[model samples]
Target: MSDATSARCVKCWVHGRVQGVGFRYTTQHEAQKLGLTGYARNLDDGSVEVVACGEGEQVEKLLAWLKAGGPRSASVEKVLTEPSQGDPTWTSFKIRY
Candidate 1:
């Protein structure tokens, strides 16, 4: 099956100075570099939404990278784990906006 909107996944809301600092792009790079498929987008609430739709060991690596404050310009103070229903039409990691 394709990596559809209902893929097994982990969601995260990366907080603190995350926007406008290439967080989405950096995340896309990370995800793709790891041979994973997902999407990263900016939330209006000053946070970035990320999803890694796979398994624990693999997905957690992405989550760990996020919790570690992705990309230098973005000062990630906290990463909020959220429930994910996955996303639309994304075959590989990408920036949503």
Candidate 2:
């Protein structure tokens, strides 16, 4: 288990064939399972934006999943990630509009 005191946040923009394929829902489910707190939302540009926050290890796991092409039906082309503080007010993983 990762040390919660060393938690970090990341914002990922998943591109290519990611919209309308249950990506956000799957992301939320995976993040929640990892005990992460954040939100996944669809972008107008046809990508998916995910903000995840949690212990470093868990966040890394989530990133790996994202890099692997997201959910079952997603045809991920590229993923862009950056360090983010995310929402300090978030208490759980959810699919945001």
Q: How high is each candidate's TM-score?
A: 0.82, 0.92
Candidate 1 achieves a global lDDT of: 0.81
**Model 2: runs farther than 4 Å from truth?**
1-5
Over the stretch 16-71, how does candidate 2's per-residue lDDT look in tens digits?
99988999999999999999999999999999999999988899999999999889
For model 1, residues 1-97, the per-residue Cα lDDT tens digits are 4443224677888889999998998998888876677888999999998887764456777888988889999999999887576665657887777
| Clash number by candidate, in order | 0, 0
Task: Score candidate 1 by TM-score against the native.
Answer: 0.82
The per-prediction CA RMSD against the true structure, in angstroms, equals 4.5, 2.2
For candidate 2, report its TM-score: 0.92
Give the least accurate 10-residue stretch of model 1, judged by summed lDDT.
Answer: 1-10
